[model samples]
Target: MKMKGLFLAGLLWMAATGMQARGMEHFIDELASQQEVTRVSLGTAAMALGSMFTDTYGVKHIDVLCLEHCSDEVRTKFGQAIADLHDPDFEPLVSHSENGERTKIFVKIKDEMIREMVICHVDDEVAVVRLKGKIKPSDIEQVIQDHGSDR
Candidate 1:
């Protein structure tokens, strides 16, 4: 009888943990299921190749959802969803708007390293990109400096 109680507690704990982990991912997946959106996912190997020319050195996974030619309703929904997003693990890093386009970036950090990043961009089209990796703040600063020098 004691073993049965322990098993049920274990299962409940796992379920709660999984739900927390899937908080943001669940919304992204639902959005990607829309007929008008295009979803692209890259695993570790693909990310290594795809980011060869960029500053994604430590990135292990990437998921991108692009919604082009979508209706205004869909665009508004996407924006609202991002605005309403609240996750304990992810903290807002940067948010800005330029030329009628808005961009919001959120990051999840663990052990002094960024474990996940979510970038939500809304313009004429909507784009949501999620990057998972073990990245240092200095690494991101270097990328910014490198790009800033181009101007």
Candidate 2:
């Protein structure tokens, strides 16, 4: 009985770990299923094309969700969802507001590499983007610099 209990506990731990690993992706998918949201998922091939112009070489997958002209209830729900993501695992890397629009960037890091990045933008239109891969902070900094120079 002791051995069986230990085995079951191990299985449960593994299951929980796996779920946490994909938590961001699952959240994005859930939002995508809503009638007011539009989702776009980009795979490796698309990311490869994107890397040509930006510093996306380390990004393996990207999920984008856009909610436009949504009801106030929907907006409140989305805002709460984003707020719930501000846990120890996901650190807020950047947050700013401009022209009535607010944007927040969060990153989850493991072993000194960023494993996932989530960008949430709230305004007249809500947009959320998730990027998953092993990325260095410098890679993100370079992307920001490159884009900033273009403006």
Q: Identify the candidate with maximal TM-score.
A: 1
Which tens-of-lDDT digit does each residue in 1-151 have in candidate 1? 9999999999999998987877687778879888888889999998788777775758899898988867789988988888777777889999998998888999999999999999999878889999899989898898888777885
lDDT of 1 at 21: 76
Residue-level lDDT tens digits of model 2 in 1-151: 9999999999999988886766665667778888878778999899888888876748889888888856778877877677566455788988888897788898999998999899998887789988899999887787778677885
Among all windows of 10 consecutive residues in model 1, the one with the lowest summed lDDT is 48-57
Which predicted model would earn the best lDDT? 1
Backbone clash numbers for all candidates listed:
0, 0
Give stretches of model 2 more than 4 Å off: 1-26, 48-55
- Model 2: per-residue Cα lDDT at residue 147: 78
TM-score of each: 0.77, 0.72
Clashing pairs in 2: none
Stretches off by above 4 angstroms in model 1 are 1-22, 49-55, 149-151
| Candidate 2 accuracy as TM-score | 0.72
Locate the minimum summed-lDDT window of 10 residues in model 2: 79-88
